[model samples]
Target: MVSYQNNISSIDNNADADIPVAQYVRMSTEHQRYSTENQQLAIAEYAKRHGMRIVRTYADAGKSGLRIDGRQELQQLLEDVQKSDIEYRAILVYDVSRWGRFPDPDEAAMYEQTCKRNGIQVIYCAEQFSNDGSLQSTIIKNIKRSMAAEYSRELSVKVFAGQTTLIKKGYRQGGSPGYGLRRQLIDENHNIKGMLKRGEHKSIQTDRILLVPGPPEEIETVNFIYRLFLNDGMPERDIANLLNNQKIISETGRPWTRAVVHQILTNEKYIGNNVFNRVSFKLKMRLEKNDPSKWVRKDGAFEAIVPIETFRQVQAVIEKRSKHLDDSHMLEILKAILARHGALSAIIIDEEDDAPSSMTYRNRFGTLLRAYSLIGFHPRRDYAYLEINRTLRKRYPDLISEITSNIEKRGGWVTSNPDNGLFTVNGELTISLVIARCKLGQNGRNRWIIRLDSSLKPDMTIVVRMAICNSTIFDYYILPLTDFSPETLPFKEFNTFTLDVYRVDTLELFYQLTSREALQEVA
Candidate 1:
């Protein structure tokens, strides 16, 4: 357990020692006037009045009380209380809401029980109830928890309603203006203010955001995409490829993907329509795509990038390709394409105008393989390769988050690139992780392929070789980018000294090797 002893302080005026307690302060939003500092002041006044000395402080600034995920200080406070040699007898919170507005009241109770189990009482300074364990206090605390949760529910509803109103009035609710469009800031009086750059928002409360056409090149590119799809009859994937070949990046500053291209082709915003609430993630639950009927839309909300007729033509084409075919017809088309090409793949299916895109097949059937099986077409070799690749793709984000958390726990800062998952530690050493799948070579020897992203040019490359089953990692290879030049590295075993030098059984050594202190000393 990690204790926050560094934040501990004492009041020097009192001669006699007072009961030691820890003040826990949290501010969920900048709009809230009861900031962490204000909470601390209130807690200190309460402690002083009650003849209690605040020995430690744990504060989470600008952290939501909806869940414990981002509240690291609160998590540490619980951990410290659970320790056998805890120094504080009680914890002072501003109110029950400061503890949490967890959707489930039981969750709040459980955390408080944990602290109580460790003999550390949780006292709400602003609440009227005493800290004593009585029936009345328990009832009041439970009611307060429910009220906190209710407050969040009410606030979310109000915020959603406000956003819907804004959308109806032709204001961009949130999120980036898509490719070929820029966010324009305007005041409540509808006076054109100025263009808002990426990651920049209007500082005024009454300012509204609208979408306007971006640079001439980006506008031309958007028009070209529409013309390519509607007039030239190029598929979304081909258009993406063409843009990527031309080195044109998407609005996110990343290489274009078929999905990104398709989104441009389908979204109504490109045709000067304001659409809102197409998806709902209320109470931080899993996101669910709302039905078309549930979507709130306002037409002619902005200047159209593509002509309405051209946009409608593209949508008609997409809908004709998507909704015209039934499951059996789609499968039959896939079978015919497989027979014609002597193999089946996403790219192959996408390239064939006669067949729907691979995404359609995967969504219609559970997966492409399942559709292939239905068509009685199986590959010659084991098709677990695709499954293994899918697992690795899903594991990458989680692994990056875990690695980042580990680095932070060791007193290092991490800056991760969402585009490629490349990250830098302490703004000095960049690191990239690649997962290698174990395979059997022609000689019947276990082998692995480690592909490095040379474009990222990370200082160190951490390669995780998965087991044969692809369920868990076999071992790790922490190699410096300078030591390895090949984009694609083949490994048979770790018998050679050169290979063994980079081999590690765990990632602990990797963190130790890349510590800021260690890197600074080496520098």
Candidate 2:
């Protein structure tokens, strides 16, 4: 005989005895009838009739079942069952649709099989089958999974059609109002209402939304950007710099970027036009940008912030400058700039009024360096090194603070030298932090160059190799003084055995290396 403890009843071998089980529930926005509470109540009744006691519950509320990516509760339940010592003998779910509406029925079957392989049965309480591994039950489950996936497909098509109808009627479908526009709330009869603030939505179901001109400063800024591009002939980057230098913030309360400036210059909404379906992400698949021909447009949908003629002129100027420049012409301009400045870079190219923007050059030729090669100009120094150094200078203080905090948390002491910024850990070992910029070689492989600080030779050097974007660290290398030689180390892409022994993904290894240990002396 087996004794049970902690309110957990052991699984009875007798078919008549009660078995311990867990309940899983999920509810998406599509249906309130299959809500989490309703699913749980149905599962409770099913468990009582089947002589099974509910021991645990997992639920995901207001989550889509199209993909398992966002279902945290279901993920946790799977992880719990994967453990070797899980107590439950069975898992009860509301139905097949509540499990998932995965486009592939095999994906839903795989999840159910995983629970069965762990010596636990998965019972679809709301389904007609007994889930007893019979041919009839298997066929019904497969059919139900396919039906659930089809339901999502049909629903998506209907929702898109409804949004298109709204767009045709000059009602805003969704998304925040752009920089120089505010969303105006109105009743069904098209009566004047109040303006909606950021993140505020219409309270009544019958209300509609429309775009209206925003504040005077925002409207003036929009006009100024158009004039800067059209009349002054300033590029997007220059206009962004002008706005940022004046401490003017964008509608999103962030510093103006070149992309934001360009969007304002090109967007049709500024001229009282509504456009929809510029992109599509159907059935939770990859998002694809659609061609302009596929876009649905409604003219004079909102109040105009910029005149139509000025907007068209600006568009023509932008198109002539960007699209009309062939590769050879762009290269000739680059050569002229290189001849005058003795070097070429994105910033230098952007500063030139006669030349197209650096982004244009990049789009024409794969990269700036590639364009330089076409023009027969090889830079004497790697211009990227300067940018990488500047980024490192901005990041070093935060990295040092994090390291110091982690060391102190582990009961260890850290002191930094004011002269060279070398850290002495536990008053025993000195460490220097260095950043290595990642570069692509001619063979299309990743490489990192580590330039050691010989003048401030410490006990250990911590090297952070940046990723291709030069924004985040790819990997870390901790090298002791004795293991490193020479002033430079060039690393290739694949060096897992030798160089990878020193590579780590996080600072946790450093914490382990400097952890405090108690010592005892024996007589």
TM-scores of the models, in the order given? 0.70, 0.67
Report model 1's TM-score to 2 decimal places. Answer: 0.70
C-alpha RMSD by candidate, in order: 11.2, 10.8
* Model 1 misplaced regions, further than 4 Å: 1-17, 30-33, 324-327, 330-523
Q: Which portions of model 2 miss their true places by more than 4 Å?
A: 1-15, 191-193, 324-523
- Screening candidate 2 with a backbone cut-off below 3 angstroms (N, C-alpha, C), the clashing residue pairs are none
lDDT of each: 0.80, 0.81
Candidate 1 residue-wise lDDT at 381: 61
Query: Evaluated with TM-score, which candidate comes out highest?
Result: 1
- Give a tens-digit lDDT track for model 2, residues 1-523: 1112211222454544678789999988866779888989888887776677899999889888988755767777877888898978888888889999988899999888888888777777777665666687688779999999999899999989988888888888778898989999999999979999887988897899999999999999999999898889888889999999999878876568777898899999999999999999888866678889988888998889999999999989877766677777878888898889888876678667668877678777877778888888878765856766786778888788788898988888899999988999999999998887787777767888777768787998888888865666887878888766653353764452334456667879899788787678888
